[model samples]
Each structure stands twice: as structure tokens, then as C-alpha cells.
Target: MSSALEVGDIFRRHGPAYVHAHDGHLGRVERRVMSAIELCRTAALGGHIEGCQACGTVRVAYNSCRNRHCPKCQGAAARDWLEARAGDLLPVPYFHVVFTLPAEIASIAFQNKTIVYAILFRTAAETLRLVAADPKHLGAGIGLIAVLHSWGQTLSYHPHLHCIVPGGGPSSDGTRWIACRPNFFLPFRVLSRLFRRLFLQALRTAFEAGQLQFFGDIAERADPQAFARLLTSAGRQDWVVYAKPPFGGPEQVLAYLSRYTHRVAIANSRLVSIADGKVTFRWRDYRHGRRPRAMTLEVGEFIRRFLLHTVPDGFHRIRHYGFLANGQRAARLAACRVMLAAQVPKAEGRAEPMAKVAPTPRPCPCCGRPMVTIAIWYHGQAPPGGPFWNDST
Candidate 1:
């Protein structure tokens, strides 16, 4: 793994040139993402020294950038996030639902990410809540943990929300648990139609309120008539809202979240090669039966596509709604458990137990004995150079 080519490797080698080429077009967030990935786990971030007491051996461990967009930093972040969410899992089947933006609206969303993405989340959640609340449908209030993914397999901008919804919800009176039929959740046709209507309506409202911006190919959308026409065109097409089969259990849900929640546009493991001013990476072609395929893009284009996914600073890409909303999550979940007669988690009554961020025993590579921290260093400090360092230059 150490020898593998990473997004960081590409950034370290070509990031400066890419930034220079883009110049005025590159935003501050994108520039920071590139710099963080490039410098992650390198001496520029500083680190510490661990010495094995039994083997009398020492090693240098560099610090991670801990930037959310850095590929190298997501593993620990995902693990920690999953640990916290573990207790929230109910003993009920969970369904994976996806709400996708149509191409025309996605083009607009690309320019006004903050505004449009917020609308996507709100309207998607609202559609599900409204549909499920109808007595003709589920007739219950459900909870959703929605995660936003903005890139397709080949790194194109494709904004969509992946929602993990429990298969059941509390009855409107909070008197009983309501579960969906086995292996089924909501009707996809109903969800798609409602999602389309709500999203188009919200988009039009944003345009009228002067919250959305248009540029380049879509500059004409700045006109009210043109924006109205765009919304009309979008409303005519069916929005894509797919409900995948219910998860086998809560474990499958956790595994899925661990993989998707903190994912960047691409993973380091997917890079096949970076050579000759081009980068080759593996991608799954869902259109072709999910077949694995290799795509080669010019180094600059690869950088451009990666930067396309850096969301605006401080904008949340993951959100909770309905019963799972942070504001009322605990009380609502307790009520749900009582109605379902599910055993209450012990940790909930006391302090929430967190996964240990660092393992206590840092075993020596030469011998299976615990290592102790001997020294520490911060950025800009001159790290000791010798056999002790782990080549974190």
C-alpha cells in the first residue's frame, strides 16, 4: 500500500501546475483540498516518535492532515462516525433510497451549490415525509439519514442524495410500531413523482428569490423567463428516486454507511497508474451491467474533476430528518423503542461510549511488544534524520 499511487501522489506531482493553469477559476476550498491531500502524512504536517521498549527500536509516525476531503484521512473519520451511529441502529430493516437531480437542474446546481444542494436535501426529505404520512401510503413518520454524493464513477458532477431510512416508523399517535411489508419499502413511482414536483417547486422559488446563480452555458437562466422555462422542462421529466431492496439487517446498513458516508470523488486504491501526463483509474460502468472499466484522463482534467467535488466550506453534506433529526432524536428514538418493544441500549442512559481514537499498544514491527512515545514534533520543526525516521519526507 505504501508503494501504491494515490490521489495525493498525483496532487503532489501535478497539483501546482493544475492550480497555475486554472488560476482565477480555482476557488479557495479547492486549493485547500489539493494542498491538504498533497501534504497529508508528510513531515510538513509533523508527527511523533514511538520507541519499542522490548526491541529497543524506534519509528517515526507522521501526522495526518485530517481534512475531510483528503482520501487518506477518511478511514479514521468513517470508523469514528460509524461507532457513534452504531447505537442509533434500530432492530428494524433499513432501506436505501436515492434521490437524483435531472441533468438540467444538475447543471444549475453546479453553479449555485450551496443554495441548490440545500433545496435538494429539504425537498427530498419533505417528499418522503409527505408521502409516508399519507394514510393511503405508510401513514407513519419515518427517519432518514441522508448523505450527499456529487460525483459519478468517472468523476463527472452528479449530485444525488442517498437516504438510509428505517423500514418502519412510529404510528401517528405514537401508540404502535408500523413496519413495511417484507423486502419492500415505499413505492418508487410515488416517490419519484413527489420528489420531482417538490424539487422543481423549490428550485423555482429559489430563482424567484434571487438565490441561484447561472454561468457559462447556463448564463441565460439568469433571466426570470428562462429560469421558469428551465423549471418547466424539469417538471415534465420524471425525477429519479430509487428504493433499493431493504437491508438484511442493521449490520448491512452500517457496512454501507462506512463505505459511502465519507467517500471522496475517488479513492487511492482505484488508481491504476499515473504516467505520461495522464492518469489511469478504474471505474464501474453501471450502464454496462456494472462492469469494471479503466478510464484515462489527462493530468489536468483529473485534477479539474477532483476539484469539482469540493463542497463549499462549512456546508453540511450529511443531514438527518424526521425522527432522526438531531434536535429531537433522543426523545423520538426512545418513543420508537418503547412502541416497538425493542431493548434499550445501555449506553444511552449514561454517557455515549466513543471508540478509542488511538490504540493503546503500538506494537513494534520487529517484535510484538508495546511501543511508547519518546518524542513529539509539530509542523516547521526539524525532524531528526536517521534510521529512526520512517521516510515521511
Candidate 2:
């Protein structure tokens, strides 16, 4: 793992050149993301020292950039987030549903990210709620944990929502729990049609209100008639909404969330090589029987593809709706636990009973005992009064 290829390596080597070549074209957020990834986990951020007591083996570990887009920083963040969500898990099975934007809308989204992305979230959640609440459907208010992913396997601009929804929800009258069919949650055609209608309607409204902007090849869409034609074309095509079978249980749900919630466009393990001014990485071709394949791109083009995924600053990609909404989560969860006759987990920040299982400690490198932090080293500072003062040491 220590010698593995990483996105940071590619960035550290050629990111400056990439930035210099496309200086004015890069957005502020994209530039920041590049800088953060290039400098992450190096002396730029500083880190701490860990020592094993028995063997007295000391090692220096650099601080992570903690930028959300940095692949290296997402592991710990994902673990911490999963810990907090562990208590929020219900006993029921969970379903994985996906809502994808049409290619025409995706082009518009590239320019109007904040507005269009927010609309994607709102409209997707609304579609689920509306469909589930009707008598012809589940007739229950569903809860969803929606995560926004804006890139495909090959790092293309493909905006979609991956929703983890419970298999059941509270009855409209709040008297009992309402469950969907054992195998099926909701009809996919129904979800797709409603989602298409809601999303297109909201998009048109945003265009009419002068909230969307078009540029480059899509600049012609700035005209009201052209934009209307785009929407009409999208409405006529079938939008895709996919529903997978429910997960085995809550544990499986957590496993799924841990992977999807904090993932970047690519991970270090996927990188195959970088040489001759080209970067190579592995990607799965889902349309072609999920065959694994390698792709190579010029250094500048690789950076350009990466920058395309830089989300708007301060925009949240993960959101909860219905019972999981922040305002009413606690009360609603309590009600849900009571209705299901399941035990409510203890509140967060409280020490668990000793009888419960505790997390395993990180093993030491030399002697296999638990490693402990002895000191911290900040950027631009040397070790305090030590002969081992070299930056590389």
C-alpha cells in the first residue's frame, strides 16, 4: 500500500502545469481542490508521531488535508460518519434506488451546478414521497438517505442520486407501520415517470425565473425558445429510475453507505500507472457486461476530467429526507422503534456499557501492540529538541 499509485502523486507532479495552462478557465473551487489534493498528507499540513511502548518504535505520520474531495481523507471521515449513523439504523430491510438526470439536463447542470443539483435532490425526494403516499402505491410516507454522485466510472459528467430508503414507513395517521411488498418496494415505471415530470417542471421554472446559465456549446439554450425545446425533448424521452432488491438487513445497509457516501470519482487503488505524460487508471464498463478495463489520458486531460467533479463550495452532497430530516429525526426514530418493538440505541456521546463490544485498536507495526500518539509535528516546525530533526525523517 505504501508504494501504491495515488491521485495525489499525479497532482503533485503535474498539477501546477495543468493550472498554468488553464489558469483563467479553472474555477476557484477547482483550483482549491487541486491544491488540496497535491499537498495532502505531506509536510504542507503537518502531522503527528506515533510510538509503540514495548518496542519503542517511533513513526511520523503527516496530517491529512481533510478536504472532502481528497481521496486519502475520505476513509476516516467515512468511518466516523458511519459510527454516528449506526444508532440511526432501523431494524427493517433497506432498498437502494437510483434517480438519474437526462443527458440534456446534465449539460445544463454542468453550468448551473448549485441550482440544478439542489433541484435534483428536492425533486427526487418529492417523487418518492408522493408516489409512496398514494393509495395505489405503498400509501406510507417513506424515509430516504440520498447521496449525490456527479461522475461516471470513466469520470464523465453524469449526475445521479443514490437513495437508500427503508422498506416501510409510518402510516399517514401515525397509528401503525406500513410495509411494502416483501420483494418489491415501489413500481419503477411509476417512480421514473413522476420523477421526470417533477424534475422537468422544476427545471422549466428555474429557466423562466432566470436562475440558470448556459455557456459554450449550450449558449444557444440561453434563448427561452431553445431552452423550451430542450426540455420538451427531455420530457419525451424516458428517464431512468432503478430499484434494487432490499438489503439483507441494517448491517448490509451500513456497509453500502460506507462505500457510497464518501467516495470520490476514483481511488488510489484504481490507478494503474503514470508514464510518458499519460495517466492510466482502471474503470468498470457497466454497459459492456461490467468488464474491467484500463483507460489512459494525457496529464492535462486527466486533470481536466478530475476538476469536472469539483462540487460547489459548502454544498452538501448527502441529505436526509422525511423521518430522517434533522428537525424531526429523534422523535420520529423513537416512534419508529416503538412501533417495531425494537430497542432504541443509547444516545451518542455517552459511554456504552462495558458488556458491549469495543472497537479494536490499531496494531503496532513492529511488535503488534497498540500504537499510541506521543507527539505532533506541525508544518514549518521541527521536532522539539531532538537529533532526528530532518524533514524527511
The positional error of residue 81 in candidate 2, measured at the CA in angstroms, is: 1.0
RMSD of 2: 4.2
List model 2 lDDT by residue over 1-393, tens digit each: 234989999999999888888888988999889888988988767887777777777777888889999999999899888877777777787899999998889999999999999999999999999999997898888899999999999888899999999889889998788888887988999899999999999999999899999989899999999988988899899999998778977778887988999999888888889999999999999999999998999988888888888899989999999999878898998898787766535432222222434767567888899977777778777654343334443
Residue pairs whose backbone atoms clash in candidate 2: none
- Model 1 C-alpha lDDT per residue in residues 183-290, reported as the tens digit of each score: 888888999998998888888888888888888999998998888888788888878889877887777888899999999999988999988899999999999899
lDDT, residue 95, model 1: 95
Q: What C-alpha lDDT does candidate 2 achieve relative to the native structure?
A: 0.86
TM-score of 2: 0.91
> Candidate 1 at residue 204, lDDT?
82
Instruction: Tell me the whole-model lDDT of each prediction, alpha carbons only.
Output: 0.87, 0.86
